[model samples]
Target: MELLNQFYANEKVKQTLVNFITDGRLPHAVLLEGEPGVGKNHFARLIAASSLCSGEKKPCGQCRNCRLVLQDTHPDVMLLSPDGADKPYSVHALRELILSCYVLPNDGDQKFYILRNVHEMSEQAQNTLLKIIEEPPPHVFFILTCQNHARILPTILSRVVTLTLWPCPVEICAQALKERNPDTDEEECLRLAKQSGGNIGRALSVLQDEHLSRIVKNAQEAAQLICDGKEFELLCLLNGYNRQKDDFLLFLGELRQIFVEALRQKYGASDKNFLPGAMLNRISALQTMRILDIIDKVSGEAAQNVSISLSGAHLCSALQQTLRG
Candidate 1:
């Protein structure tokens, strides 16, 4: 039942929501849309608690209603998610949720239904839920959390008040990391924050990934090898990556970041590139973009059930063309 006092970034979102809650103008249906690690779920819970809490200060953590919501024992709050090997919400499940909305609140004056991964709901399921929201019960409120809003139906999107969360700022992410893990080194926090692209969850996860340094080193080596026209060595390295999909992906990401820094360097912009000056000087901006295009194409192809060696071959051939171009 902690107040919405500390979302690391997105002050505009935080303040607008607080205004909605305090002004008693909160919408009946809210769509919290954002990337996976952007805290949409966390905000949904805070909104739910605020809606249900019966205190002098809404969601006063010590209030009985607030405590119940925080404990997840509140009878009026319903949490619906994909169930039983199903990746998407089923029509039957949506019907059940719709029916439950009609039931009287157990203790609180309001009932809140928090749906996770609403983007996974099928079109029919969304249509079914649409009917309920169209004329929602006076006591019921719906909060839907989704990573992609495009997957949701336009009609449903029209009904809900959509709030999109973007990546947190680097400083805010670093501060949040420091607050969460006091013993973590500040330098490491800043490095992770910078690498996370403003994603607090991603920054926190970077701290847990021990192989990050190895990936960075490998990326640097890959750049040097490609620039030196060591095709055989590069092919051998690519073959080695065939068995480690996650590491390969991380390596590719590091390679992209390095080239991005190189692009900044080319434009005389300050960057945190650790690549050797010789390697940076070897690749022009056009060459870098071409290489990145190859990587992106390979990444998309990898999504299919293709053989890893085939992808490795493609990568080697593409690198040759990029280097020559």
Candidate 2:
């Protein structure tokens, strides 16, 4: 259970899962829902390992089954995902997987299928999976991970046990980061933990990726510029991403997170400062809400293959107008 112990926060969910494993009452179909970096995939793997472990303590980590699962070489544990960049599970692939479910396990009495980001499956593909999930073979288990469960069909959802993962406290997350990267500076780890709002995966990404770190830094600067009503500076900053749609999307996501923190602070719901106290004083809750709306609209447009230059310009103009109002 080393992996489970390392999974930060969500004590209740972890206990429930431990109970299910101990009682041999683990469900046939499970859906893990959470935003990116919340550890849904890691949780899914934990369930898979726990179910397939041959050792006394479930998921002993050193057991043969546990080792195989950790290495992603388990014969009975299959990892499935969408076909391509568009990230849609094809009906043909779903059919093949469904057919394989009836086959006996390769190494153990039970088999597990870990489906990553199942929310990407199209309606047709989902319907094709419905029958198998509704009445899966006794030896087969389906573990699905998704950022949002709302995109899944209600019928499919009805057949599965849904578990949601959440961010841990900042101190816990920072400590985890420190443990994972002992050579890194403690102050840097805490800064990343705060920036990511206690999401370990996100903080780790920023710590490891210089480009991503730069994006976050730029987004913070943009937020400050918006609060200062420096339209020209903000526009110049945004125009730097005129040809980088992917980077622009990431920038918008980080920008949106700052506004969300701002909104939370305005309502006295959060004390973690994403912006300076002076900047927060300059913007009202209503203005933060409007900026969030603008970011959402621009983000959607940017995702739809809109020209990055135009989207950047729109974001700058809309943010300035909202702040002025």
Model 1 weakest 10-residue run by lDDT: 267-276
Summed backbone clashes in each candidate are 0, 0
Please give the lDDT score for candidate 1: 0.78
lDDT of 1 by residue, 161-250 (tens): 999887776677778889898999898877767655557876666676667766766777777887787888888877877867777777
- Positional deviation of residue 44's Cα in model 1 after best superposition, in angstroms: 0.6
Question: Candidate 1's error at 290, in angstroms?
Answer: 6.5
Off by over 4 Å in 1: 83-88, 209-237, 245-297, 319-325
Which prediction has the highest TM-score against the true structure?
A: 2
Candidate 2's TM-score reads 0.93
lDDT of 2 by residue, 1-325 (tens): 7778878998988998999999999999999998899998778888999988888888788898888898888899988777555443788778888999999998879999899888888889899989899999999999998899999999999999999998777788889999999999899888888888888899999999999999999999999999999988998999999889999999999999988988987887775664578989999999989999999999999999899989988988898778776
Query: CA lDDT of 179 in candidate 1?
Result: 86
TM-score of 1: 0.79
C-alpha TM-score for every candidate: 0.79, 0.93
Question: In order, what is each prediction's RMSD in angstroms?
Answer: 4.3, 2.0
